[model samples]
Target chain A: MTYIIKTNNLTKIYQGKEVVSNVTMNIKKGEIYGFLGPNGAGKTTFMRMLMSLVKPSNGEIIICGEQVTPTSFELLKRIGCIIEYPVFYDKLTAKENLDLHCEYTGYYNKKEIDFVLDLVKLKDTEGKAVKDFSLGMKQRLGVARAIITKPEILILDEPINGLDPIGIKEFRNLFQKLSKDYGMTLLISSHILGEIEQIADTIGVIKDGKLIKEVLMEDIREENTAFIELKTNDVKKVAFEISHTLGISNFKILDEATIRIYDMKASEGEILKTLVVKDILVEAITRKNHSLEDYFLRIINGGGMNA
Target chain B: MLKLIKLEIKKFKLFNYYKGVLIANLGFIAFLSMIYFLERNDGNIPFENFEMAMNISSAAIRTTFIIFAAVLIVKLIIDEYKSKSIEIMFTYPIGRKKILTAKLMIVVAFTFIMVMSSTSLMAGLLYFAEAQFDIFPVELSFQDIVRNVYVNFFYALATAGLSLIPLLFGMRRKSAVATIVSAIFLATVTSTTSDNINLFSIIAIPVSLGVFGILIGYLAISKIEQVDVI
Candidate 1:
C-alpha cells in the first residue's frame, strides 16, 4: 500500500522535555487515519509537527513523497489543516476571511467559496464579522476554509471541539464524503473515542508522548472479544463454581457481584444451568463485545500490550 | 513577493485605520499651522527663516509617522502573535519570510503616504495663512516648496524604516504595549533632537536607524521558521 503521510521517529522536545517522542506511523492514501489519545498526550504536538507549524526536534516527516523540512512550502500546498482552535481576522466577515485564505493558497474560485460555506452550513452568515460568530460557527468556517481548495490531504486537530450534536454529525458526514468522494487522505485527532470510532478507518493511539498502537478499525471489529458478564449475590461462591465447575481459566472476576467469562467454550444456557444448580443467585447476565474504548483503555494502562 | 504584499494590503480593513490617521493628520496640520501663525505674529520670532519652519514641521510629522508605523506593526504583526492568528498564516504554503516582508512593506508604505500627505497639507495651509494674515514677512518660493517636499519625503521614508525597530522588540516579546512604548520613546527622542541637527544629520540619523531596523527585521524573519508557535 502506498502511504501518503509517514513519520519516522518523529519527536518534539520543549524545554528539555519530550512532548512527542519517537513516533513512527504510516497513513495510507485515501484512508481516514484517526489519531486517538488523551488530553496532553502529544496528539496536537505531533499534528503540528506534521503541518510544519512546530519544528520537530528530531525525526523525519514524509508527506506525499516529499520530506517535510522548514522549506517544504510546495509540499504544504497539497495539505489542508486546522492545528488547534480556528483563528481569523475578527474584524473581517466570514466570506472575507475565506477569500483571504484562498488568496494565500493561490487558489481562487469564487463560486467554490459559496459551495464550501454551504457544505459547512455557514451559507447564510451574510457577511457577519467573525468576532460575532460563536465558537461552533468559527469551527465550521475553519473547515470550510480547509476544504475550499479541495486539498489532497487534510489534518485536523480536535476539529469538533465546540460543535453541537447536529454540527458534529454533519461534520462526520462531510469528512466521510470528503474521503470517499474525493479520495482525500485524512488525519484527524480527537479525544472523543466514539467520534473517531465512527469515522476513522484506522486509529493511532498515543499515550505519554508515545504512539502505543496503530490498529485497523476493521481488524479491531473483526477480532472483537465477546464475553459473558454475570452479576450475582454470592460473589465468592459464584467465582468458585465458575472456575471449579466450568473449568474455564480465561475469565476475570470484575467485582463482588460480577464475573466476566472471556472463554466461550460453554453456551450461556450451560453456564446459567451450572450457576443455578450451585444456587449462586445470578441477578443478571448479558453478553457484551469489547469496544474501541476498552481496547484503548487497555492499551493505555497495559503499556501497549496486544494492541 | 509582490502578490503576497498585495494580498496583505487587501486583508487589512484599511478604512478602520485610514479614517483615524486621516483625521489625526489633518488635526496635527491645523494645530501646527496655528502654532506657526502665532509664532509669526509675535514680534520676537523671525518670519523670513523658512528653514526653521520646515524643520519644525518635519519634526512633528516625523513623530506622527513613527507612532503611526508603530501602531501598524502592532496590528499587523504583534497582534497576530497575541491572538494566535499568525499560526494559521504560518501553515500556509508561502514562506514565513514572505509574510514578514509583506507586513513590513505595508507599514512602510502606509507611513510614507501618511507622512508625506500630512507634511504637504501643513505646508500648503501655512502658506495660505501667510498670504491671508500677512504674518510672515518671507515670500514663499518654488525652490522652498521643492526643498520642503524633497526633505520631508526622505524624512518620512526614514521614519517608516526605523519603525521596524519597535517591531523587532515587539515581535521578540510578542507584546503590543512594548511595541507601542518603544515607538513612543523613539519618536520622543528622535523628534526632540530633530530641531538641533543639521540637514545632513537629519537624513543620516534615521537612515542609519532604518538600516539597523532592516537588519533586525531580517533576523526576526530568519527565526520565524524555527520558532514554535504558541
Candidate 2:
C-alpha cells in the first residue's frame, strides 16, 4: 500500500529543549489517522512541519511521495488544513472568506464552495459576517473553507473543539463520509478520545512531544478485550447466568445493581431475554469497554511514572 | 503570483475599515483650497502668502498621502502577523517570497492610484479656487504643474518606502504607535540633515529608496519563508 504521509526520525528542538523528539510514523492513503495527545504535546508542531509551515530540525517528512520543504508549493496544493484557531477577517462573510481561500488555491468552483457549505450545514449563513458568527459557526466555516477545493489530504487540528453534541455528530458523520466516499486521507488531531475511537482506522499517540505508540484499530478490536455491562436488581443472578450460560467468569460486580462481563461477546437482546426467562429483571444492558480515553490516560500516566 | 494578488485584493475589498484614511486625504485638500479661496477674495495676505500657502498645502498633501499609505499598509500587514493569518497564506500552494511580492505589489499599485487621484483632486480644487477668487496675477504653467505633480508622486513613493524600514523593524514588536514615531523620527532626521553630509540630494532619494526597499524586501522574504507558523 502506498503511504500518504511518512515521517522518518522527525524531530524538532527549541531553545535547547527537544519539543518533538525523534519519531517515525506512517499514514496510508485513504485512511483516517487519528492523532491523540494532550495539550502542548507537539501535535501542531508536527502537523505544521508536514505542511511545510515549519522546518524540521532533524529527519525527513515525505507527503505523497515528495519531500517536504519550504518551497514545496506543488505538494501543498494537494492538502487542506486548519492549524490552531481558524481565523478570518471579521468583516468578511462566510462566502467571502471561502472565496479568498479559493483565490489562494487557484481553484475556481462556486459549486464546490456551495457543496462544502451544505456539507458543514452553513448554507443558511452565506451572507452573515464572520464577526457575527459564534465559535461553532466559525469552526464550521473553517472546515468549509478547508474542503472547498477538494484536497486529497485534510489536516484538522481540534476541528470540533467548540461544537455542541449535535454539531460533533454531524462532523463525525461528515468526516467518515468524506473519507470513504471521496477518498480523502485525513490527519485529525484531538484530545477527545471517544470520538476518535469511533472513526479512526489507525491511532498515533504522543506524550511529552514524543510519539509513544502507533496501532491499528482492527488489531485492537481483534484483541477481544472489550467488556459488557449488565444493570439489574438481581446482579448475583445475572453474574451466575453469565458464568453458567456464556461459560466465562472473568467478571466483576461494579455496584449494587451492575456487573461487567469481561472480554466477552454477550448479546444484548439474548442476554436480556435469558435473564428475563430466569426470573431476573434487567434494567439496561450496554457494552462496556476500555475506551480510547482509558487507554490514553493509561499511557500518559505510565509515561509520568517512568519519568 | 497572480492568484496571491487576487487574494490580497479580495481581502482589501472585503474588510477595509479605514475609509477614514481616504476621507482624510480629500478633506485636507478641500480645507486648504477653501483657505486659499477666502484669502484671495479678501486680498488680505500678500502674493507671498499665496505662494507660501500653496507650498505648505502641497507639502501637506504629499505628507498626508505618504503617511496614510504607510500606516494603512503596515497596519494591515502587522495585523495579519498578530492574528497569525499569514500562516494561512504561507501554507497555501505558493512560494513564500512570491506571496510577499504579490502583497507588496498590491500595496504599491493601490498607493499609486490613490496618490494620483488625490494629487489631481488637490490640483482641481486649487484651480477652481484660483479661477473663482482671482488669487495670483500669474498662472502656473501646465508643464510646471505636471512636473510638480509628478515630483509629489515620487515624494510620496519615496516616503512610503522609507516608512517600511520602521515597519519591518517593529513588526515583531507589535506596537504601531512606536513604529510610526520611530518612522517619523527617522524621516525627519534623514531628510533635514543631508546638509552635514556630502551626498547629493538629487541622487539621495532613489538611492535611499532602493536601499530601504531591498532591505525590507529581504527581511520579509526571509522571515515569511522561515517562520514556523504553528
Candidate 3:
C-alpha cells in the first residue's frame, strides 16, 4: 500500500522529557487511521508534530513526500487540522472563521464553506459569534472547518470530546463519507475506543508516550474467535459441571461469578441442557467473540507489557 | 505581506479601535488646555515660548501612543500566545516568522499613524489657539509649524521603535498585564527626564531606545522555527 504520510523516529521533547518518542508510523492513502490513547499519552503531541505545529526535537516527518522544515509550509496547504481543541476569533461568526481558514489554506472555493457547515450541522449558526457557541457547537464547527478545504489529509486530535451520542454517531457517518466519497485520509485521536472502533481502518493503541500496537481492523476481526461465556453465582459448581458434565478442558474460570469456555467443541444447547440436568442454575449463557475491546483493554491496561 | 497584515486586522477586528483613538484625541486636547490655563502664573505663561510648549506636547503624545502601541501588541501577539490560538496560525501554510513580522508591523504602523495624527492635531490646535487668542508673545510662524511637523515625524518613528520593547517582557511571560505594565514603565522613564538631565531631551536617546526595541522584537522571533510554540 502506498503511504500518504510517513514519519521516521518522530519525537518531541519538552523540558528534557520525551512526550513523544521515536514514533515511526505510516498511514496509507484514503484510509482512516485512528490514534488511540488515554489522556496525556502523547496523542496530542504526536498529532501536533504531524501537523507541523510542534518542531520534533530529534526526528523527521515526511508528508506528501516533502520534509517539513520551519521554512517549508507548502505541504501544510494539503492538510486540514484541529489540534487540542477548536479555537477561533471569538468575535467572529462560525462562517467567518471557516472563511478565514480557507483563505489561510489557500482554498478559495467559497461555496464549499456552506457545504461543510451543512455537513457538520453548523449551517444554522449564521450571525452568532463563536464565543457564545456551546462546546458541542464549537466541536461541530471544528469538524466543519477541518473538512471545508477538502484537504487530502485531516489531522483531528480528540475531535469527539464533547459531542452528544447522536452527534458522535453523525460524525462517524461523516468521517466514513469523507473517506469513501472524497478519498480523504484521516488521522483521528481519541481515548475512547468506541469512538474509533466503528469506522477506523487501522487502530494504533498508544501508552505512556509510546505506540504499543498497530493493527488492521480486518486482522482484528479475523482474530475474534468465538467463545462461550457463562455467568453464575456458584463458580465452583459451574466449573465442576462444565468439566464433569461436558468433559470440556479448554476453559478458564474468570472470577467467582464468571467462566469463559474457549473451545467450541460443545454447542450452546448441549451445554445449557447439561447444566439444567445437573440441577445447576445457569443464570446466563451466550456465545461472544473475543472482541477488539478485549485486545484494547489488554494493551492499555497492561501498559504495553502484553504488546 | 500586506495581505497578512490585513488578515491580522480582520481576525482581531482592530479597525474598531478608531473610537478609542478619537477619545484619546479629545482627552489629549483637554489635557493640553489644562496645561495652558494651569501654567499661566501672573503674566508668566508657559506658551510665551514656542519650544517649551512643543516639548511638553511631544512628551505627552509620545507617552500616550507608546502605551497605545503596547496595548495593540498585547492584543495582536501576547493574547494569541496566552489563548493558544497561535497554534492554529502556526499550522497554516505560512512561515512562522512571516506571521510574527506581520503582527509587529501592524503595531509599528499603528504607532506611526496614531502618533502622526495626534501630534498634528496638537500642533494645529496650538496654532489655532495662539492665532485666535494671541496668548503667546512668541510668533506662531509657518516655519515653526513646519519644524513641529519635522520634529514630530522623528518622534513618531522613535516612539514606534520604543513601543516594541514591551513585547520582550510580554512574550517572556506570555502575560497581557505584564506587557501593558512594561509599556507604562518604559514610557514614563524614557519621557520623564528633567531638562537639565538633557538625556531624553535629545533625539538620540529615544532613537537608540527605538533601535533597541526593534532588536528585542527580532530576538523574540529569531528562534521561531526551532523553539517549541508553547
Cα error, candidate 2, residue A50 (Å): 1.4
lDDT string for model 3 (A1-307, tens) is 7889888888788889989888888899999999998899999888887876778887788888788776778888888888887988888999999888887778899999888888988889899999999998999998898888788999998888899999999999999999999999999999888779899999888877788888899998877778999988887888888788789988989998889998899998998898888887888999997777887898898877534
| Tens-digit lDDT track of model 2 for B143-162 | 75676676666755665455
Among all windows of ten consecutive residues in candidate 2 chain A, which has the lowest summed lDDT? A298-307
Candidate 2 chain B weakest lDDT stretch, 10 residues: B192-201
Better model by DockQ: candidate 1 vs candidate 2: 1
Q: Estimate each model's TM-score.
A: 0.91, 0.81, 0.92
Task: Using DockQ, give the best candidate's number.
Answer: 1
Q: Give the alpha carbon lDDT tens digit for every residue of A263-287 in model 1.
A: 8998789999998987779899999
| Candidate 2 Cα misplacement greater than 4 A, ranges | A224-288, A304-307, B14-22, B34-54, B123-134, B137-143, B146-150, B180-210
Candidate topping TM-score: 3
Judged by DockQ cut-offs, the docking class of candidate 1 is: high
DockQ of each: 0.82, 0.60, 0.71
Better of 1 and 3 by DockQ: 1
